[model samples]
Target: MAEEIKVIVFGLAHEEYGIEVDKVRTIERMMPITRVPKTLAFIKGVINLRGVVLPVIDLRGRFGLPESDATDSSRIIIVAVNDLEVGFIVDSANDVIDINTDSIELPPEVVGGIKAKYLRGVAKIGGSRLLIMLNLSEVLNKNEIIQLEEQEV
Candidate 1:
């Protein structure tokens, strides 16, 4: 049998979610951000990391959840989308977990307020634990990001 795909899971507003580890580059603590006016509410702002300006988005806010102040557990999970680097802020990062394809199921008609179209699948962990696997490309599409950038300009 083929090896199960592993993903790095995290929490945002009490919900567990994950993205393929291969898609994730690194995870860092919350850094200073320069807020840009007239952008999407989910976009907290941009951060300069090692000379690279990365746009940071609050996953909770993106999912239409109440915004909260960054805490010690807050982290920015850097991911590569279409060769572009973007940072996503989460409440806390859990750990890397391997899940078999058979263990993954299609997301229900809806997830919280997010449409299932944005999800890749739902991974079942322990008995009652479920992790929503995200479709990185759909979640961070360049066109949408560019649109937000244009709004800032």
Candidate 2:
């Protein structure tokens, strides 16, 4: 009733982003991925996590940002999408915060050149910090999700 919800904060391309915490499964350090041929450019490969094989996408690549070599802070954020779980690589994830829902504003046509469909909203935090909220479903759009499922078949 505080008009607030918790989010898992992460970074991609030096910009901040957030996702509803409930959708996140886990966060892991960068790991080895097996290349899957003929897939989308953003789909780096697949990672065998524990006993589950999950597709991993580089958020930067998906967002059409310049690729950078992985650093110590690189991370994989596993998130549940529809009936499958996928992993997304980010620069890092270090914060869990409660952001007031009322503070969120409709996303502009573009943010740093990222497509508007990929965004859920934009929120101002701490009077100066801006956080980009992502619509996971849109980020992994229906077409992409379908392709991923087909690859599994």
Query: Candidate 2 local accuracy as lDDT?
Result: 0.91
Poorest stretch of ten by lDDT in candidate 1: 144-153
Give the winner by lDDT.
2
TM-score of each: 0.90, 0.92
Pairs clashing within candidate 2:
none
Query: Residue by residue across 1-153, what tens digits does model 1's lDDT show?
Result: 646998999998888999999899899998899998888888889999899999899988777789999999999999997887999999999899898878889999788777787799898878799899998888887687688668757
Q: Which candidate is the best by TM-score?
A: 2
Clashes of each: 0, 0
Task: Evaluate model 1: give its TM-score.
Answer: 0.90
